[model samples]
Target: MTSFEFPGQYYELMRRDFRNLAAETDFLASLLPDGGRALDLGCGTGTNLRELGARGYCGVGVDQSASFVEYARRMGGEGVEYVHERVEDFESEDRFDLVYCLFMTLNYLPRAELRRVLRKMRGLLLPGGHVVLEFGHLLNFVESYQPYTVAHHRGDGVLVTRLARQSLNPRAANWRNEETLLVREADGRVSMYDNFFDQAVLTGPEVRELLADAGLHVSAEYGGFRKEQVPPHGRGPVVIVATAEGAGAL
Candidate 1:
């Protein structure tokens, strides 16, 4: 399976999407403990880390992309540290009060890799720490659909845009697929990558089992961070908040 990395343009798009930024900030704020230390896993460009730091929390971000990490470090303040490393290989001498994996970043890994990463996340949390995870709902892709396309106008000419059809390996334990497309214009050309995570459909039960195996308990699962329960055949994303079973007492 191919790994997903947001291009610089996409990262900037996320930074400008006020609605999404507000929703995410609200969700993270709700999950934070008083003056807590927070970890942003797969933190692209460190946008969330900067927000957390602005809110007076000690925030650290980790990502495999060196350019992204450098950009994040330059953009984020001193309170927010950006680390260049894969989530599975990230090690810390101290535990955090909260760990977050957002934007379906976990879906990039296969089942075993995901499990191992989750174990690492568990190990990086303090006793009362919580993990807030978000991923796309797989049920949305049960049926095939035409690709969505968009084009932008350049000063001299029009940009060309196309989205190609993609499919998930239904038989695999980690059922997921990606849609890759080309973005071409007079200035430059680039590939845009978007992945559909059907892991919720193929591994929801297994995810719960694995969390339990890791000594974590599911506190809640929402259709989105807005706090709505996921419905049967829900086409929205899934946001999960989990914690160590007895961590609340710590």
Candidate 2:
């Protein structure tokens, strides 16, 4: 296996292959206030922040990965900033109109940590500000399970291929994912990187309860990127849109 000091350096390369950032941002934009501050918890590579900035929103992206933060900073943009810090320890005097944690970032945290992070997010937001969370549902894992899958992308004379695998541990109530990346550079050099992640398996009701405990009231829920409501045990992404208690509809 080829080694990389910071595998996250190539994160952007494979991100688009798996997600439609443009569409995702479009949906998020609709939920955001007009031209106010925003915070991206667990922002990976700052792609979403850059998109938000383009839409005239000043934003801050916080992540624990130094490599990802460095990459995001180098791809700088007006009204966008990147911070290197874990979500649990991140602090800011600025109150945001929108605070979002996307792509199942919170799922990686244990229940206790996730609760703390949710509370922290709530505290960082202005009254009536929104908090959007994307979670990986247990049904999604079960329905989408496969031995392995491959994704390939080429851009700017660089090519990347990723192999992904997932498994569910019912007893542990956690889902595990493994990914391997094969990269080919313009210089004809080849390298490989591997990564693994474990996410807690949570149902919609459980997520709602957690949000309630954190003083956030759920206003909307979706199974995926679409705005439509999903079944309680939906077999796809579990997206929760909420605002602090007593903060009425937007």
Count: clashes, candidate 1: 1
Candidate 2 positional error at 150, Å: 3.5
- The TM-score leader among the candidates is 2
Q: Which stretches of candidate 1 lie above 4 Å from their native place?
A: 1-7, 14-19, 143-164, 173-202, 247-250
Q: By summed lDDT, which 10 consecutive residues of candidate 2 come out lowest?
A: 1-10
Best by lDDT: 2
Candidate 1: tens digits of C-alpha lDDT, residues 1-250: 4343544444454345323776788788877887888999988788887877888888889887776777787775747887888877888887998999987677655556777778888888987789887765456445433345343323233232424444445566344444443545455755555533334333466667777777788988888767777877766667878898775421
Cα lDDT of model 2 overall?
Answer: 0.81
TM-score of each: 0.78, 0.89
- Candidate 1 clashing pairs, residues 3+ apart or interchain: 138-198
lDDT (Cα atoms) of all candidates against the true structure: 0.68, 0.81
lDDT of 2 by residue, 75-171 (tens): 8877999888877789899999889988878877765687788888889998778999998776777787886888888877888887888777878
